[model samples]
Target: MAENSSSTPPGTPPEDSRPRPQYGELAPEGWSWTPTPDERTLATPDAPVSSAAPVAAPHPRGTAPRWDRPVTLSLLVLGLLSTLFAVSMLAMITDSIQLIYTQLDLGGYEPDPSVPGLVTAGIVSVCLVWLATAAGAILLLARGRRAFYVPLIGAVLFVVVFIAFSSAVLATDPTLLNDPNLMDVYGSL
Candidate 1:
């Protein structure tokens, strides 16, 4: 009925005969292993440890700015400016039309029916270009779509082409280009 007093379990070598751990002596009963500050604390002994915190996954960079931010505000302002340009272009077309109509009423000049058709076509084309540009701006501002660049470039090219065409057409018909009466009407608007 007596309790055993031996340090080693039955069949194991005696405590004095076993090799000692290199770093520390055998701990007393109920002693548990714990890591030092220099050593990483691990959820479990078998878990991997590092001197520093686990590497946080890198976040993506160069994301588009939010709507409430400065970039978005700039785009909105540009869009408003574009809208104003479009409106001014429309007003110019209207003034041009009114000038032609007034000239026809006075019988001082006869209208070339072809002029109206060509002017109408030009205005329509310009309007289409402006619309496409506005759409591209919206897409760029809202969704950060790089595809908007294509339409934006096209719109710019269209504007250049329109100016060149208008200049050429006006140059060929000096009366249409130099009419002081028409210039006055458009200038008034």
Candidate 2:
């Protein structure tokens, strides 16, 4: 058997890093021990130990968080403005429909009868802008996610859809494309 390297001088006991037995009682050879954990948790026969990670901690709540306060205020303004913008676009679509039908009587110009589809498309575009602005505002305030691009995207979509519809309408009559009245009303000539 290998000799105990920590063997003390003759007639003295060997030293051990672990705690000694009570009352100087002897421990068996090769004895080992593990200390209790720093945290003590009670377990019952029905409880199973789980090694899964703990759920995420919730964010702190307050009446008005610093970032949320300004965002909410800005969202309210944006919501109102977006609604007005949508209404204006709707008015424009109605005006165009009226103009096309009335122009049909102007010296046999015969404006295309397919204006309802264009009107529907225009309305959808306007609604998309309003809906997007509302949804973005709500989501930003609720989740604190970045949604500043929502307004820009909605505006661009409305513009693109309107331009396409307008060009298609005017294309049916090239003479109307150069009409001063259209230029004055659309201001996009």
Candidate 3:
């Protein structure tokens, strides 16, 4: 071979013309790269290792999550209860009116003493119930429950209808006065 300008160092044969080994690489005879015990353990592939523990089972889908807000549930319950109470009162008034009409034979008769008071009381009760329902609905909506709004509005409208019906009944029959016999019953007051 042509004289290799890349000569070996002194006290070494020219056969060592290859590149010197790095600190981490295998060395010449009588020397070798040996990994530490920890390095050897890591390098030995025993089994696949996971960095984190397994997670618990996930919750089922499509069910409503548990509610944390007490006010929301309270408002919903209040709205429902108030609605039921108003409906019950209205139904009672209706039944009473029907009974009066049927028993007194006054289905199409002129306005009389007993009937006017029932109509007036029904109207007042309906108005009061409507106010209560409206208040409950407002609370429910403010607490993020939107389902109660329609029923609440319906209750208010029903109250208005009752008021109108009462007014018409009173206006059509002048005998539907607050005191037809005022001079007899409460003339002192």
Q: Any runs in candidate 3 off by more than 4 Å, and if so which?
A: 1-145, 178-180, 183-189
Assess every candidate by TM-score: 0.40, 0.44, 0.26
Return the lDDT, model 3, position 44: 80
Those runs of model 1 whose alpha carbons end farther than 4 Å from true positions after fitting are: 1-62, 65-111, 140-143, 146-155, 168-189
Reference-based lDDT, each prediction: 0.55, 0.59, 0.54
2 or 3, greater by TM-score: 2
Candidate scoring better on TM-score of 1 and 2: 2
What tens digits encode model 2's per-residue C-alpha lDDT throughout 5-53?
Answer: 6665777766547675753367576776544553233322445667998
Off by over 4 Å in 2: 1-83, 86-110, 178-189
User: Scored by Cα lDDT, where does model 3 land?
Assistant: 0.54
lDDT of 1 at 142: 56
Error of 2 at 23 (Å): 30
Q: Number of the top candidate by lDDT? A: 2
Candidate 3 TM-score to native: 0.26
Model 1 worst lDDT window (10 residues): 59-68
